[model samples]
Target: NFILFKTISSCLFFFFFFRSYGGKILVFPFDGSHWVNMEVLLQALHSRGHNITVVRNSKSWYIKENSTYYNIITVPVERGIDQEFITNTTSGIMEFERGALPLTSFLHLTVTIFHIMIEVHKIFIDFVLAMLNDPDFLKMLKYSNFDLVLTDPSWGGGAIFAKYLNLPLVYNVRWILAKEAHFSLAPSPVSHIPITGTGYTDKMTFLQRVKNMMFYLLAQIHYYLMITQTYQQLCEKTLGPNIDFNELSLSADLWLMRVDFVFEYPRPTMPNFVYMGGFQCTPAKPLPQHLEDFVQSSGEHGVILMSMGTFVSALPADMTNEIAAAFAKLPQKVIWRHKGDRPANLGNNTLLVDWMPQNDLLGHPKMKLFVAHGGTNGLQEALYHGIPVVGIPLFFDQYDNLMRLKERGGAQILTLSTVDKENNFLKAVEEVLNEPSYRMNMQRLSRLHRDQPMKPLDNALFWMEFVMRHKGAAHLRTESYRMPWYSYYSVDVGLFLFGVFLLVVTTVFILMRCLYRTVCKPKVKQE
Candidate 1:
């Protein structure tokens, strides 16, 4: 009887696993934050018995391997220009903040953006060459027969590699789409869709729209000057001649963007573009006893969690003191994730630690507000838990994210450039806490965000499988991708109509002049 039961269990396991047709899934992720976002989805895929392989950079976070389902192939690449530029540029931006001056003018901003794009192109070229230089890796990839490739859309190397391998490509954007990517995938009217750094929304004033258009045009110029030739060279070297990365990316089978209307403004989307925001979010676990006790002791004032995420952990001493002073005055208990020495002015209501379970803490019933650097992951988690925020955005897309939250009325921004940092921070904190409207708006959005018919992860899984099963789901692709720019925008049709109008006006004017000369001038002729 024991043998019979064991045989039955073994047969059932084989029946489920073998019948499902698990395939080899290859992932290409670029940065630390991107890797963190991909881990959740990768792990889920592995658990379903698919073999997952990752082409990873040495600097990225670790991915634990399993003998049965996971493998990691590390590629050694130097991040030379990008590292130095980012460090120097962000430091310069901070120095201006300390001096209480405007950080950048339009010209400076455009020049800086162009420099970054050029540096990024250099780094991406090196990445592609590194993989191509390794013969063993190339051979492995060629023979592995991957069913689908999930890649970062921001990194053009992945698109080149996917085209070379002749696999169906799926883009997994860890953040909101960059302007160019969004434009290629769907129609984005400049009047409504705000660029990542501009902080505008769907409703735009005329001047704002003009600014948006300038930003868009500048981005196009930057791409042409900095990215186009270099990207084409890399593609030619690896995947044969005349293969355009932009064209290949437009042909990608699916685009899974990490955004939803809950946090993003409403915009036109295509059939192939999927909104899989909050895929990394999960039901929060119970906080450990010590943390729970710390929060519960705060009573009515409750607790607030502060984190700058993994990238920007360091803060200037003066700014640190200013923040500590505000925390010192608040009745609410503060839990701060800090890397440097603890601030000297920390009050009894504050606790400083090197690490934090941020999601768990935010989900606590006693949790009241969040002090965030406005990273997308943290913001999404905070929103999912229905916590309001006092946002202090420093760089990158933080400004835009914070602005969106303020537009939604769930957050208030207090930058370091404010005249009185301590006072502004305190006031912002008090306003969010004292006002019932902020929390009420947060609750409403949170409910809408959570009330989806299917969870984001499940939705992603379904579509991923759908693509694999259908062998790229080519039927869903838009005809716009195949059309020329002039055809897609009806430029030629507009030109033809204008020409016809001009011809009709010319003919009418000529006839009118003829009538004047032949009849109206008869009396003068006779005289």
Candidate 2:
């Protein structure tokens, strides 16, 4: 067995050895979540003998000044996720498809609204900004051309940028969202699919199941209309009237889903979708002696880490107070990331700070659990380290993500709706800390998640070269690629008519034979 295993491993290594991942690459990671991951990828690619460039707008996450980056351009920000009026509007879901519109999910509703409105508002803002950037963009284009435009799926504006620049785009999703499954424009493989009527066991009611389907259709319809209207104007303003909107939407291609398949629920997906996990890792910098010592002393008793990330940091004080009290009660040491002075009457066991090295904390041997806001990046980091989670979902895809983690028995969720309640926060932390299942499940998943023979970054870089080598071959397409659900499954009005025809024919034949024997004079002979 040992000899056989060695032989197989050696053969596989040689097979992959011939593939070229070492090539010139440029990545445009517009969001903060994309920053570290892209950096990790560039470094990986660099080690593989590839040249890489990372460009950004002023809003881009902090990038080191003089690095191996072939070229780094910091463009001016015409717009950003933050806007004056946007910050005030406390909703994310906009009504279009009732199913797509979240009903029971307050968190999903809020976060969806943020994504929709910001991009909708930014369409015009980015266009005008791009025009202002035409001179600079054109000048940069002259110096170098990118083989692949790696982008965060959230940056719908980046899609436009890719289109304008005439570059092939590959997407990296920071969040685990169902939208990518249905949205044809995403260019990645559809990761999640409906379980019911489609054939799976779910406890949701028939009406509820239908509503879920409706939600998907609604979301697609909403984006379709929005993108159409927005793109039409963009064409008129930028490309003039000759180009058809439909063609542009279809022609927009290339996708790389950054999610690790092992971590998400079982679902149908396509080949265009690839994983780029572990894209977020910080460069080696020595930690402060105090920080290192803090990590060392916090032994088997376990330490809990908490953070809500930046955008939603402006949380209600009541929620903040509830969290503090909960932290004070835990047997474990708690390090909570927040802003402003520590509230009076804090406990020695609880440490409050304006910032914390979340990834680093998760990596510590003493780290017991992570209390996160359920943002995709935080969730990914938690999963990467195999640390159990206590989710306090705020908005957007947070609820769904937390739900997934909860269902998997990998985490505990404490809704923001009840966070201000002392009992609620305290109970949640206690449940997470005491529950051995969450940790066991987390470890199980972490093993499976990391079981990959090759890491996601290496896999993506390899496949990317495969794309260039194959000259954009359809080999990357999955079995799902060949069939649209309706056509492939033969579930349609046409199939219904065919079944009706067969039924009618069988019924008529039986009736005609009966009548012939009873009334057509052949009955006497038969008797």
Candidate 3:
């Protein structure tokens, strides 16, 4: 009986482990909202008996074994950022709280120029020091007793922490982390400043793309200098002095980005680069009964949901009115997330609110379309609910996100630059609402987005476990910084030095021969 039981248990173990699988999973996301899919990922992995842990900035969240299920755990991280930036408190560069005035335009311009120079100088020095003296550097390693580090690629800290700990890094691309990485991760194809989208599939013709490229290059320069410096400072505040950021691993073991190749702008592709486009972009739960009824009541004209995203504000009333006027004309009820400016005589069909549970609102069946500011999260939410969209891009990657959706034939993009005009705003909104093609296209994209072979949450779990099973996938994502651009291009400084040596040697030989002939010829003849 004992021999039979041992053989049976051995066979069961073989069934589980024979395929070469299982290991600890460590996830480090930028923030809590970013962790929404991560939470689901953990649950799925737990069912497979994988050990899981998460490091959120300084906080640690983990999962433990339960009788029937795995238990979730959270470890509080208590370390401070030893950072001092040019704009430490205010908009001023070099540490002064100055968005101030000289009382005149000319003086203000002059002051601003001087202020910018000061800011540049301060930023360089501050960033250098902050990177070297990061207080959280040692703490990250201590907390992350990890076999691998999974990071939101945009979150520089994750990459930095992974490098310091020498853990295998996997970049979960959400926003545009890499411009040319086959899977386009950003929002807009237009290449607007700070605004993301487009990915590799920017829809403009060659001339348009060239134009986009020009702006893209300029933006990249600005990002490398300004935004990346801030991120670098954050990395430094954690990575410390000895670790060379210039030589850190950038490519994750696998880049599990929230992208679907079927829906994205076409570009290059990588095996390790997993496109989890509509990753758990799912709604949290159902909508309220009242909100559901509001949509149900709209018979012929369905309701349109408008939101400008959480971070951006609709400050300029000009753009807001264009939206209001469009809503005013539409027969459909507009459930606008109207922040500030409570127009005394808003259309009775429009409902104004400061805070809302947006995911629930999108999930509602009666919702017809979404008028968005082209945020990635917002776009995903709309797509998740299979709602059509008219994207009015304000700034950041919102512009690019809108462009990609436009390219996919699922949504329409109206530049905010033109939104102020009454006809333009009205026409664009009309096109999105009346067009059957857009709705059909969106539904098609939704199906393809959903018909992914595996759920994003599941795919994410597979990759997490993959790292544990196969050891680290570090060699896969080659950090570009580790090799200088020139070095990567094989423009060896050593080769240049060798060329210089050869030139000098030839010159010296020519001169020596000339001198030897001149000095020795007459002397030998005389002798």
Instruction: Give all candidate RMSDs, comma-separated.
Output: 4.4, 6.8, 8.9
Give the per-residue Cα lDDT of candidate 2 at 69: 47
Q: What is the lDDT of residue 22 in candidate 2?
A: 51
Q: Write the per-residue lDDT of candidate 1 for residues 232-320, one digit (tens) a residue.
A: 67776677676765576678888887878899888888888788877888878988889988989999889988998756655777778
> How close is every model to the real structure, measured as TM-score?
0.89, 0.76, 0.67
lDDT tens digits, residues 3-88, model 2?
Answer: 99999999989767753445556565644444656666676667766677766665443565468644676666555544333434
| Ordering by lDDT | 1, 2, 3
lDDT score for residue 136 of model 2: 66
Q: Which candidate is the best by lDDT?
A: 1
Q: TM-score of predicted model 3?
A: 0.67
lDDT of each: 0.78, 0.61, 0.60
Better of 2 and 3 by TM-score: 2
Off by over 4 Å in 1: 1-19, 61-69, 80-89, 97-100, 103-106, 174-180, 419-422, 482-484, 504-527
How would you encode candidate 3's per-residue C-alpha lDDT over 400-421 as one tens digit per residue? 6776777778787776445666
At residue 408, give the lDDT of candidate 3: 75
**Model 2 misplaced regions, further than 4 Å:** 1-22, 59-70, 82-133, 161-166, 174-178, 181-205, 235-254, 278-287, 474-527
Is candidate 1 or 2 superior in lDDT? 1
**lDDT agreement of model 1 with the native:** 0.78
Worst 10 residues of 2 by lDDT: 90-99
